[model samples]
Target: MQEAVIGLSHLFMTVFLCCFANFMVIPAITDVTMAALCPGKDKCSLAIYITGVQQAIIGLGSLVMPLVGKLSDTYGRKFMLTLPITFSIFPLVILAYSRTKWYFYAYYVLKTLIAMVTEGSVQFLALAYVADNVEESRRGSVFGIMSGFASSSFVFGNVSTRFLSTSATFQVAAAKSVIALLYMMVFLPESVVKYRTESTETDCLLEKPPTKTWKLFKTLPSVNDIICLLRTSPTFSKAAVVAFFSNMADVGLHASLMYYLKAQFHFNKDQFADLMIIVGIAGSISQITLTPILTPLIGDEKMLSTGLFFSCAHMIILSVAWAPWVPYAAAMISIVATFAQPCLRSIASKQTGPSEQGKAQGCITGICSFANIVSHLAFSPLTALFLSDNAPFRI
Candidate 1:
């Protein structure tokens, strides 16, 4: 038990570092895009279109995330975890060196390519790692705790960004990413020992066995495999439905919110950081404290519903903000709204056995990735239209 806790602590530290590196740049990226693509303009159609295109391509690449997860079940979480963290560093280095128009385009291209593999893989792998070590009964709280660490990192990253210059933010982020990768490589232990043993035995059983590399690819989860997994459990299917729409709303809000704020209120990087800090602090408190207490009492289902309801409320408030402070007020809703993901993930994790945790989480993440593609397609145009001078109707 002590060993498990120690392993989880290492995992949490890795998550915090990686997330801090990633989130620190969110506020600065918008300004960079605006300056590069449309200098002095808050609303840039080119920036929106480019972002949409990049998101679409990344979503398409993320379809392979499940494959990586499935492979982690055969390999090890520590090994799989290294790939994304390492890939994440390259784009940040590019941006750290320069944020000029040509350099921004270079960063954009590399970032899109890297994000396909790096985006959701870290979180999903971490969740699967937790599932490997945690008991079913305690999975919800543990998942919440893990998310809380990420939220804390989000808050810290944004706070750092609030003070750092734009160039310094990217440079610091790249450094942190390197640190995260190294820490994981050195400290995090493998969690799938039993699965690795089973895989070895299975490999030995084959007559004139193929290479492990070929077998790994051959065993990649297919469409029918995902379908079977979904149809095999009613609970999982319901969770899949929730995951799809929840992620759809999330991606839409993420894609539009910063641009909307910049256009609607002329928010700069510091204002963006302030807004994110509110959401992060609220989310961190809810996940770290409220979730563990409330989930067991009210149940994950009720918690999920409560979260989704408030998530909608917050988005509605943001859409119709009368004052700059309204967005900050709406961000407070994340205190409860943040309950959605950990609960949803907990419920999903319960549907699969220990050995299949990676596959199951990957499938769920793939569903969310598909939602990202759809949300980008639908929301990007609307955001561009509404934010542009010639809008069909004003909000």
Candidate 2:
């Protein structure tokens, strides 16, 4: 029994680390799959459109993402982390079976719906759990380590799924998720500290029981509450804007990268996946090795500034140059940027009280989601217009 308890504790730590890693994978998976599945007639164009549409779908989910955070805060964190995984099983099965373009669209829509709960909320809850459990002195290291695992998972998942047949990829993804679910069920504990309240009325109104997660988001927080929160908290307001721009830049770069490859150097789907895998691995290393060491040394503000500056420089270089080393240079810069993410997240966490972490994270995700929606809507048509077979510049 003691051994079993010890084993479960270890499992919770693993799940805590890997849950966000799993969320980090959605983009890498979508990128590789669209590259494989999109029709060959104007393949680059179709791929961008498909990716954009998918992003827009996920963006809509992001708009409602904070509800999950708030519910988890009011109720419990473990349930929030588990809810999305439970909901995701069916859509992934559908995604696995889908072949036609209409089926692909349907699957993506389902994915978007599930992502609303999972990508933003699950991670927010998980981070709250971490903040609650880990000491402040070590929180940065813990977050850095979790980010490393998540990025590593992205690298491996991209390589493995990208190489597999679409059917095989789906099967593998389903299996991975099932394993994750089972681990959570058998081993993970409720990480939230117990809180006592007087009235059942508030509980009845707010508490979203784990079993009835389907109804979790049925009741909405008022628009006035949102506006008041934004106005009252400058940190939340500024974080929201930062979240939006950051996601816009991230999604725009991702959606355009494959086309940029084909347009500039004429690489195919497999080659692009390989490059992504390499870049993902580099990012994983940077987040693991460089972040923990650098963050404490330079602090979040200076570190984030330096990271963003380098990332912008790389984007400019990619926009202009198509040399053999361009991808390598770009990857290095992006890895530095990736290293900064967890640090920024930790800074955001410190801006709010412990109880409000979920809402704060949700606000950030919601803003970013809106940004992603805009970028996707604009990037697809813009890419098509700017880069045809006869265009002068690749970007």
Worst window of 10 by summed lDDT in candidate 1: 200-209
Candidate 1 lDDT over 66-151, as tens digits, reads 78877877777888899999999999999999999999999998899888876799999999999988887778888998999999
Q: Which ten residues in a row are the worst by lDDT in model 2?
A: 200-209
Candidate 2 clashing pairs?
21-150
lDDT per residue (tens digit) for residues 1-395 in model 2: 23322333543454543443343344345444544565443246666677678778778777876676666666667767777767766666765675466766676777776775565565556666766565555556556666666667767776775667766666667667777777787777766543324332122223232343445445355555456556766665765666667778777876776676666666654566566677778777887788778877777667767766776776677667657557756776667777556766676666555555566567667777788889989887777666667566544
- Each prediction's RMSD to truth: 3.7, 5.5
Q: Give the TM-score of candidate 1.
A: 0.94
Candidate 2 vs. truth: CA RMSD?
Answer: 5.5
In TM-score terms, candidate 2 sits at 0.81
Q: What is the C-alpha lDDT of each candidate?
A: 0.88, 0.63
- As a whole number from 0 to 100, the lDDT of residue 254 in candidate 2 is 68
